[model samples]
Target: MKELEERIRREGAILSETVLKVDSFLNHQVDTELALATGREFARVFEGEKITKVLTIEASGIQFAMAAGIALGVPFVYAKKKKAVTQSDKVYVAPVHSFTRGETYQVSVDQRYLNAGDRVLIVDDFLATGAALVGLVDIVEESGAELVGVGCIIEKSFQEGRGLLEAKGVRIHSLARIAAMKPGEVQFIEESGNRQLIEERA
Candidate 1:
């Protein structure tokens, strides 16, 4: 987690008070070593949960979920943002609003990949609005699977995502939590109580 915090400080771009762009490393051009390390960290955090499968939304969440799956020795499933011809009719569906893209879309997962007997851990790239993640949780509930918890790579702590998920009694673990951010500056919620400065503007 320390390494992750360091990366954010060094490479993350503070676009605004609300948008912190980490595409250069975390999402777009990913660092394989960091991704695996994040998976191992999540595995360590949720060690005794007996997680059977890892779930995530497609695209950005896929890599982290796959990493988590490998660490946990389980398969991973991703919900498609749009229903495709290859998808079956018997799928769990939920609505999600993407604040970034300014649109709402239906996300779905095939029923065969999930069921009442499995325990699920949801993983994602960012935990900001909680929209996509909330949709995944709804699908998991509809499938009758046990919700283990959620693991996130980066979390905008100033946002309502964590609060919303917590209201549903979901446990969340985020490697890097941003307390606040603005152009050329960023602040992190220090889980270790050290309160380290991530970045500061000149």
Candidate 2:
């Protein structure tokens, strides 16, 4: 965790007053060492929960989710951004609005990958407006799977993402939580419990 905190402080770029961009190592560019550590940390947190599968959205969430699945020795399932030819017809879908891309999209997964008796752990790279996670959670619930928890690499604490998930009684675990981000500076929130802060700005 210390290494992750240090990496964010060093390589992460504060894009304005809110967004902390880690594209150089996280969101875009891949950093395997850190990614593995992040996954391991997530596994450590939810180790004894009897997680049968890890659920995540496509693109960014896949990397960490895969790593976590490897560490936990569980299969990981990712919801596709769009329907593909290879996708199974029997699926569960959820619509999500992405604030960053200014678009709304649906993420879907094969119903066979998840079921009513499954215990799922949702993992993602970032938690901004909570839209992506919300959609993923919806899909999991549709399959009647028990959502054990949510694991995020970088959480924008100011966005009300955690509050939204907590209201549903889901436990949230983030390796790095940005408490505040200002022009040329970013602060990581170290405390837990319900507290609202600014997540991003133009």
Candidate 3:
């Protein structure tokens, strides 16, 4: 995950104490090679879990989830933010609040895609609010699937997201964990259990 940390340091925009904009590379315009590498990281981290399916919320989570499914040789499913006519009538639904969008969505997954027999790994782009992932976890519990763990591309370690997931006993692994951030300065938790500060130059 050093490469990912490096990318964030070099390309990510620190807008505020609570906002980091990675759209230039991570989201709006993705780096395919990096995305695949993240999948490999998730696969390697959860290699022994025997995952049967990958789940994610729609939009930002789709690519990473698909990459993970490909690495694990399984099909990926994404919960629709808006139920479509093609969406399943019988589904597991949960309320999700998007802090970035200032809105709430009732996300859902088709009953046919998940059940008691499947072991699931949930992947997503960021872990800040824990809202969407918590909703997905609720759906997984509703389906009776075994949740192996959650894999995140980046995590704001200072936030309540990690705490919320831990309270629910959900295991989480994030590639780049930000200990703190602000305009022109960011700190990341190193693998050695220490924080490394990076200062942006003008």
Candidate 4:
């Protein structure tokens, strides 16, 4: 997690008070080593949960979910943002509003990949709006699968995502939590027991 925090500080671009772009290493051009390390951390944190599958929304969340699946020795499933022609009719669907894209879309997962007996661990790139994640949670519940927890690479703590998920009784673990950010500065709410703060400015 320290490495991740360092990367964010060094390479992350603070576009605004509400937007921090980490495309250089986290999402677009991914650092595979860092991603795997994050997966291992999630696996360690949720060691006893007996997770049977890793679930995420397609596109950005796929890599992290796949890494988690590899670490946990389980298969991963991604909810498609749009239904495909080949996809079956018997799928669990949930509506998600993307604040960034300014649109609402239906995310879904095939019923054949999930069911009542499985335990699911959700993973994602960013935990900001919680809309996409909440949709995944809904689908998991609809399938009657046990929700183990959620693991995120980066989280904007100032946002309502964490609060929304917590209100639903969901456990979340994020490697880097941004307490606040601005055009050229960022502050991280330390996760370590000491509660030490880490601040960076461009």
lDDT (Cα, tens digit) per residue for candidate 1, span 1-202: 8999999999999988998889988889999889999999999999999999999998999999999999999999999998898989999999999898899999999999999999999999999989999999899999999999999999988788887898999999999998889888887888775333332320
Error of 4 at 147 (Å): 0.2
lDDT of each: 0.91, 0.86, 0.91, 0.90
* lDDT for each residue of candidate 2 in 1-202, tens digit (9 for 90 to 100): 6788888888888878667778888878989988988889998889799999999988889899999998999999989999998888999989898887899987899999999999999999988788889888888889999999999998888777877887878889998887778866777776463343443321
The better candidate by lDDT, 1 or 2, is 1
Model 3: lDDT equals 0.91
- Give every collision pair in model 4: none
Name model 1 segments beyond 4 Å from true.
193-202
Residue 43, candidate 1: Cα error in Å is: 0.2
Better of 2 and 3 by lDDT: 3
Question: Whole-model lDDT for model 2 versus the true structure?
Answer: 0.86
Question: Over all chains combined, what TM-score does candidate 2 have?
Answer: 0.93
TM-score of each: 0.94, 0.93, 0.94, 0.94
Candidate 3 residue lDDT tens string, 53-159: 99999899999998899899999999999989888699999999988789998999999999999999999999998999999999999999999999999998888
Please state the error at residue 174 of candidate 3 in Å. Answer: 0.3
**Best of the two (3, 4) by lDDT:** 3
